[model samples]
Target chain A: MFRILKKSLKTGVATGRHPQATQSSEPLTPEAHKKASAFNRSLAIREVDTGSCNACEVEMNALTNPVYDAERFGIHIAASPRHADALVVTGPVTVNMARALKDVYKQTPDPKLVIALGDCAIDCGAFKGSYAVTGPVDRHIPVDVRIPGCPPRPADILKALTDIQERP
Target chain B: MAETKSCDTELKTAFPSIVQRDTTQREFSHFFVAKDLLPTIARHLHTQPGLHGRLALLWAVDNRPARNTYELHYLFTLEPSHRWVLLSTELAKDDRVFPSITPHIHAAQWYEREIRDMFGLIPQGHPDLRRLVRHEHWPQGAHPLKKDFPWDRALGRQQGEHRFHRIEGEGVFEVPVGPIHAGIIEPGHFRFSVAGEPIMQLELHHFWTHRGVEKLFEQQPLAAAVPLAERVSGDTTFGHSLAYCQAVESLRHLDVPRRGRYLRSLFLELERLHNHLGDVGAICNDTAYALPHAHCSRMKEQIMQLNDRLTGSRFLRGLNRVGGVALDLTAAQLAEIAAEIDRMEQDFSELESIIAHNASLIDRLEATGVLTERTAWDHAVVGVVGRASGLDQDLRRDRPFAAYDELSVKVVHYRYGDVRARMRVRMDEIHESMRLIREIRLRIPQGPVAVESSPRAQAGEWALSAVEGWRGEILYMVMAGDNETIQRCKVRDPSFVNWPAIQWAVIGNIIPDFPLINKSFNLSYAGNDL
Candidate 1:
């Protein structure tokens, strides 16, 4: 235990600042704060991998790492969809996972946000003409935010997510 | 390289009916055996003395319009000699059945089942012929890989039921997990027969992420297929792309520039370092040890940032091309990488000491998931999973591709085959990869990174390429079509072989410990399903 404490002390602080977008000087209107209060204070997210190559999932995982430390912003990944306020979906919707993705979306409580994370999820990027894909995430469900990149960087994901929480 | 001539003479003498085909190179040999004599000859080869033979891959190719037959290719890797032996047989169009080798060789079980599902080919006398890749929505009589079937045809959904083997007795019931898991991981269904706490049996239903990757490869030109290969499994961008490029390069006898080969090795080591670091943290995270997990995650992030700075893609995507690498590193960049590796090694050693001293962490890891060497060999497990179970096989050392022949690779093996053993294997490999990177930076010479050549091969030519990926040995078999198109490209991710071994690994372990055991293996669902 002494070694653990020593190591922790030596490592010091690891949390880094979020993207500049998160630090807006312009304050939100009173109506916007009222509308976003439920999610802006604390957001519970549930990530669903429809049929990703898993690069997006890796970036999503990095959101909670020491550098990003998304939890410090009152955003934590929930264990179940029923407890989540937002659904972060990745990958081109495969034929086998279309139904499951819908069921998970329905299970989330009302006034929820759906994020299509990655170019594959947004437009079926590299897997466009394949027989197995059922197009993008919006083909199956209504998406509110679309973050694009082969896999968007972790900071990009954090900024988009924080932007959504503020604008919701 | 050892000569396989003596073994060839013995094989001809032992089986007079088997006919050996002429080959251009000596590293591998191909043979044509009668359909009925396949199982017998395979069994004989398995038991052949002085040659440790293991069935590596089995796939069927459709040849309908050109020839009224479906050819079956059985690839076997002989240990210690690093020679590959391929046994092939043609099935006439009217008869789509071939003798199954799974009864004698346990490693051929999933391959036979997959052939049955994808090509509509029957493996005669095979046990447990269930749905391997085709999920419930896929209608019956829909074999997508058949040449007659159009690549983009959408089919109507069909209803089907998968029967799971259920155990019945007092205090025994089933626990069914997800195709959508609780965590941010990929999808796969796991059914466990449990009595209160300990698990009696575990069976998995994968292919939930199958995007018809092979069929997609057929639609694209040979040059455009590298992007598809990179996404085969996102985490293995470097490994999959490298394997696909090597397969194309070997088919045309194209050699990567001396500098390109060394850069490939350097990037491959960087990919390994990042993945191993992430996996160590994930395994620790599963065991509720947050300190090591945090530190390892930080180190992994640093490596990924380095990759992004060098290659412009965090996962090292688009770095590999047909003949060589797309990007080259300068002296200052290489020096920066070397210094970064030094700092990471120092920080990692401290984290290792902390993890090694934690009694609770060790208590959760040791003897939790035990996969014996016998079971691992039967399943043909590869990579760290095989090495942990004492298989003592490393494709980098045995086959030696991508500058591995020039650089000495230290293979790490553990006999205990537990969670701790797997973790130890990853930890040691992390250090080894760092050392390899340092050596590559010092030895890489000045030359062109790629050659300007459009690869050309005979219409029916094919080549098999294997790379020791971070997860395991990734194999790609590319068959060239007319007009430089790909007829068939069979990708064998190590997860396809190692996923089944997880069933054996989790036996007798408690239900709560499943996460730790699964994370220890850390097999890729997208790679396996593809």
Candidate 2:
């Protein structure tokens, strides 16, 4: 325990400043700002993997790690969709998962925003023409935001989350 | 090489009628066998003292319009000699039936079920004929892998329900979990039949992430398949791509430059380092030991950032190409990698000491989810999961690939297959991976990183490639088509075999500890589903 504490002190704060504050900031539209107001500065996200390769999920997990520390921004991954303010969906909606994705979206409380978390989720990405895929996340549910990368990096994810909610 | 020659002679003597199919690839020996004799051959290979074969992969290819037959290929990795034997059999297109070898081999159960699902090929007398990859919503009689089926054809959902294997008793009740999990993870359903605290039986229904990857491979050129392969399982991006590249390279007999081989091996080890660090932390996090988890996560991020600096993709995507690696490391870059590894190693030792001193953390890990050696062998489990259960197999040493033959790889194994054993294996392998990275840096030769060659895969030719991913062994079998396209590309992720073994391991263990045990194995659902 002493060794752990010593190591922790030596390492110091690993988390970086929110990338949104440092990176370019586009003016938010009034309509978009109204939607952002619903989150009330604190966002509870319920992540749904419709048919991802799991790279997005890895980055999502990294969001909670010491370096990213997503919780510092008042963002927490909720245990259930019912408690969530936003639905973070990844992957090209596979046929098997389309129904489940819809069910989770329905379970989320009203005024909930759906954010497509990766390239696959946004536009089916590399898996565009496959028969098993039911197109991207928007094909199954109404997507309010799209963070595009093969998997959007943790900093990008953090920036997007920050952009989605109104600044304090 | 001598051992392989003798093994070939032994097989020829055992089955005089067996037709040997010659190939330039030295890693595998192929043969055409009669359909009726396949099970007998499998039994002989599995039990015979001279050839203790492990059933590595079994996949079927549809040959319609061109030929009136479907081809079934069974790949076996032979122990002691470190060679692979591939047995092929042809079934008439009209009569798409073959004897199921699962009764004799046990390891061929999922493979047979998968073949039955994808190709509509019935395995005669198989115990479970239920769909493996095809879920409840998939329309009946629609086999996605058949050559006749269009890649972009649309089909409507049909009404059906998945039947979970039940444990019927007075106190038994089923607790079903996800195709959507609580945590940030992939989608898969788990049905736990529990009596009070202990689990009586566990049935896993995976493949929710099935994007028909194999079918998609046939729709594109050889060059485009690398990106598709990289996403076969997101975490195993390098492993899957490397296996696909190796298979393509073997098809053209293309030799990667010496420096390319060293760089590829180095990246492979780097992949291992990041994943192992994450897993060690994850297992601890599940046990509520947040200190090691936090430190390990920080270390993992460092490696990932290093990967981004070198390859532009944090997951090392686009690093592997058809003939060789796409990126070459400079001396300064090599030195940077070495320095980072040095710091990581020092930090990891301190973290290990912290974990070792925590008796409560060890208490939760020890003997929690035990997978016996017999069960692991029967299931043909690969990689760290198999090593923890005393399988004594590591493909880097058994059948060397890349620069592995040039550099000696120390295989790590443990006897008591439990959570603790799995953790120890990962920790030990972290050290081993770092050592390999150091060795590659020191002795890396000066040469072109890649070769200039037209990757025109010959028609009617196929080759198998395997890589030891951090999770386990990733295998890819590619058959080329007429227009330099893929006819059939079969991907067998370690998760596919290791996933079933988890069911066996979870038996008698309580509900809460499932996450820790599952994290220890950390099988990929997307990899298995694809």
Candidate 3:
């Protein structure tokens, strides 16, 4: 127990001041960034994997780790869609999961934001032309932001979440 | 050479008139069996003491325009010798009905269902012929894997209710969980028939994320299919891609450089290390032990960052190509990796000891979800889950591939067949993988990382490649088309075989313990569903 505490202390604060750091830098859209930063202090997110390779899910999970520490930004992954302020979805929206994705979006309260993470969710990525894919997340639900990469880095995911908060 | 000849002679003598043609490949023996004698031969091979055969995979291909028959392939691994024998039979396209091997070999159940769903091939005596990959809403007789079905054709969604088996008892209640889970995990429906807390039956409905991976492979060039293979299961990215690359390389008879082989082996071990570490921690998390989980997650993140440094992707994606790997590690990077592994080993040992000494954690893990040897063997579960159940099958050691043949791999096994045994197997494997990575780094061969070769289209040839992925044996059977394109690529992720074993594992266990047991196995939903 002593060793764990010692190690924890030695590791120091692993959390980064991502939002504040981004705000200090020259933003491409300063007005939009200012609006998003002023609106909310904390955001509750519900992660929904409509259809993903799981690589995206891994990066998202890493956001909660001590290194990224998304909780430091008042970003908590909620247990249910009903309790969420935003829905972070991944995958290309597979055929079987299309209805479930819509249901999750509908279940979330009004004034909820839907953020699409990963290339699959953004534009169907590598799984575009296959029969099982029902196009990207935007085909089913309105997406506020689309984070693109085969799987965007954890830092990128955090930035996207923060950027989404800036949206009017 | 003598053993191969003798085996050929033995097969020829046994079958004589039944065996149409026999061709020996790099890894397996392929025999074209007479169509009518498939069931008899399959049954004989499985039950015979000399053969000690276990069905590894069963799949079918549509050879239309080129041939008027649907070619069915049955791959069986002969025990004791650990040699693979590929048996194939051609069913007339007009009359696409073949005797099901599921009646005798229990593992053929899902394969038969899949064959029926994919190619419209009727497995004559399959006991449960329900849809495997295609959901209940799929239009009848609309088999997607057939050559006639266009790869990009989108069909309208049809509505139909799937009938699940219900247990009839005084107080039996059914609890259906997911297609959408509560946590940040993939989708798969689990229906538990329970009386109070104890589970009477467990039925799984997966394939929610099946993106027609095999069909997608058909549309891609042989070289371009590696990315598709990598995404088959996100965690087993390297394993699946390596297997796919090996299959393509073997089919074209392209030789990979010695250094490339060593690198492939190193990356595979690294992949195993990170996945096993995460699994060990996740299993603990299920039991309400947060400390170990947090520490393990930290360790896993470090490994992920290391992977990002080594390769471009955190999951080690885009490293595998057709003939060999796309990336090569310099001596400095290799040295850094070796040192990092050493530090990881020390940290992991400390974390494991703490978890080991915890009585409450051990209580939740030991004998929580025991998968008996009988059930494991029946399902032919591979990887850590199989090793935990006394199955003692590791493809890396038994059927050596890449640089594994050069290196001595210590296969880890435990006879307990419980959650604790599974965890122990993973822990032991992590140590073994660390040793392997160190050895590979120290003694990596000097050569080009990849061979420069332009492989042309080879018609009427197929090859099977099996890699011991973190989860288990990831098998890829690739058949070449007329223009350097994949005609049919059948992927059998370890989860495909092991998912059924979960039902048996959760037989008498309580509903609350289900998540813990499931985590212990940690079967990939996307892999299985694909």
Lowest summed lDDT window (length 10), candidate 1 chain B:
B1-10
Error of 1 at B440 (Å): 0.6
Highest DockQ: give the candidate number: 2
User: Which numbered prediction scores highest in lDDT against the true structure?
Assistant: 2
Residue A34 miss distance in model 3 (angstroms): 11
Q: CA shift at B209, candidate 2, in angstroms?
A: 0.5
Counted clashes in each candidate structure:
0, 0, 2
Candidate 3 residue lDDT tens string, B1-530: 66656666677788886554545465468788887788888887788787778789988999876888888999888776788888888887598888888888889999999989899888998899778788888777778899888877885777887778889989999999998877788889999999989999999888899888889998988888898999988988999999999999988889999999999999998899888888888899998888888888788888888898888678999999988899889999999899999998988887777787788999888888999998888787888999999988899999999999899999989998999999999999999999999999878989899987586748778888899999988899999987888889999999999999999999999999999999999988888888
Q: Arrange candidates by lDDT, descending.
A: 2, 1, 3
Alpha-carbon RMSD to native, per candidate: 2.5, 1.6, 2.7
Cand. 3 TM to true fold:
0.95
lDDT tens digits by residue: candidate 2, B1-530: 78888888888899988899887887679989999998888888898988999999999989875787999999998977768999999997598889999988889999999999899999998999889999978998889999888998886898999988877989899999998999999999999999999998999999899899999999888777899999999899999999999999988879999999899899999999999999999999999988889999999999998998888889999989988999888999999999999999999999999999999999999999999999999999999999999999988888789999899999989999999999999999999999999999999999899997675778979888999999889999999998888999999999999999999999999999999999999999999999
Write down the DockQ of candidate 3: 0.60
TM-score of chain A of 1: 0.86
lDDT of each: 0.89, 0.90, 0.85
Where does candidate 2 clash, by residue pair? none
Q: TM-score (0 to 1) of chain B, per candidate?
A: 0.98, 0.98, 0.97
Q: Which of 1 and 3 is the better model by lDDT?
A: 1
